[model samples]
Each structure stands twice: as structure tokens, then as C-alpha cells.
Target: MSVPVAMLMAWFCEMLLLNSRSNQSVFRYSASFR
Candidate 1:
């Protein structure tokens, strides 16, 4: 429950979300190009 731990968790969640979005975008782009 420390501030640093909370910040780290938040950053991790944000990175996961970003990765998911990029994967979705890559899949769509590849499908369209093919």
C-alpha cells in the first residue's frame, strides 16, 4: 500500500493496455495489407 508500489502497479497496468492496443492494431493492419 505504499505510494511507490502503487505507482509501479499503475505503470504496469498502463504498459499492458498499450501492448494490447498495439497488437490489435498490428493484426488489423496486416490483415488489410494482405
Candidate 2:
């Protein structure tokens, strides 16, 4: 509910989304090489 807490949560979620997107791209790249 606090401003800092909300900002932290948003940052965390963004990091998670970025990580998953990178992982997916890596997976696809590797699959293409197979």
C-alpha cells in the first residue's frame, strides 16, 4: 500500500518478465540450431 512497496513490487515483476522473455528467446534460439 505504501509508495515504496508498490514501486518495489513493480520492479520485481518487471525483472521477472524480462528474465522469462530472455529465457524464451534462448530456448528458441537453441531449438533453431537443432
Q: All candidates' TM-scores?
A: 0.59, 0.59
Q: Candidate 1 on 1-34: residue-level lDDT in tens?
A: 6889877766765576577865665555434533
**Each prediction's number of clashing residue pairs:** 0, 0
Clash pairs detected, candidate 2: none
Q: Which stretches of candidate 2 lie over 4 Å from their true place?
A: 22-34
Least well predicted 10-residue stretch by lDDT in candidate 2: 25-34
* Model 1 alpha-carbon miss at residue 4, Å: 0.1
**What global local distance difference test value does model 2 have?**
0.62
lDDT of candidates 1 onward, in order:
0.62, 0.62
